[model samples]
Target: MGITGTRQAYEFPAGGAPPLGEVRAWLRQQLSDVGRGTMADTELLTTELVTNAHEHADGVAELRVSVASDRDVVRVEVDDRRPHLRPRRVTKQDPTTPHGRGLALVEAISTEWGVATGTEYKTVWAEIPVL
Candidate 1:
């Protein structure tokens, strides 16, 4: 992920609801602290994952960030407690998807992404690489 670039993590309580705005701000700060720009794509994708966790998942364990030395690539992960209910894949983007309630955008912006489900939790991660 990085030789001497960025590798950081944040933990949030997954009691009642996940605070989307707070999470975003923290992410931006972390990126900025490491001299990463917090580009639009990274911001948007991370928000999506967090929102999903807020709405569907039961508990959020952590948010991890990893950046390449050149800062040309970054990976963000949202880990939540709900291994059984992993994120579902959205094959098509519905033009009229309410306000924002789908993985379609994540699928579009992420360079690569997937879900990791363990016994007690599941993580939805997306990687954004600068072109």
Candidate 2:
């Protein structure tokens, strides 16, 4: 069955953001109807975005996952409090360092991705095509 019009939103709690594993689990459950490969790709990209938000922007304000009407793509968006810090892919990554590879991974795997800046927050979104 297709997941058209299916959407889920997660707002960060007051205490702290949920564990990355929990987020992945939730996403896996939500996208279970998609192919395994597609679900894995979505989890990886979603984790990257959530990790970036926690590491760079203090914390994530919300997370949204939605399937397009045509069921051709899944969109994952992570919103953070810092509007000025837009995500960008690292052109030159250092093998020695573990930092700065998140956006690069997102760029490589996502069919299309971009940042949306609100007055008080910014959202990094990626679209993964369903295979």
Candidate 3:
């Protein structure tokens, strides 16, 4: 027998902040039957990616999540209208600087992550081993 799962898509307004608690709760529910280790990383990475989209993008952002057991991977992609402003590794002298840590956190937590650019938008995506 094979394990089965699904994918979901969500759209967030341009420059609009998503309620962190609500998003986290929704993810918890979605991955309720999965193991704790997978769920923890998924939630954290999702929050970071979505928050980054809201902060940096000029127009609406979209989130797509896919859960699949065959591949034993949970994938998340956050799409934003600003393709030019790709996430970069910044070395900041002031640790007190309010921004620039999102990608670092994502890189730390996810198994693999990268960026894809289209003419109209860009997507930052991460994948975690779910099995």
Predict model 2's lDDT versus the native. 0.86
Clashes of each: 0, 0, 0
Best by TM-score: 2
Per-residue accuracy of model 2 over 32-58 as CA lDDT, tens digit each: 788888898999999999989998898
Residue 17 alpha-carbon offset, candidate 2, angstroms:
5.5
Model 3 — TM-score against the truth? 0.83
Candidate 3 lDDT over 1-131, as tens digits, reads 01247777776644456777877787777667678888888898998888887777754477777876777788888888898888876656468888778888898888889999999899999988885
Local distance difference test, each candidate: 0.75, 0.86, 0.78
Best by lDDT: 2
lDDT of 1 by residue, 7-125 (tens): 68888874767777787787677666334444567788888888788788866788888777665677888898888896777655567767444587898888789998899889899
Task: Give residue 116's lDDT in candidate 1 (0 to 100).
Answer: 89
Clash pairs detected, candidate 3: none
Better of 1 and 2 by TM-score: 2
Listed in order, each prediction's TM-score against the native is 0.79, 0.92, 0.83
Better of 2 and 3 by lDDT: 2
Better of 1 and 2 by lDDT: 2
Considering summed lDDT, which 10 consecutive residues are worst modelled in model 1?
30-39
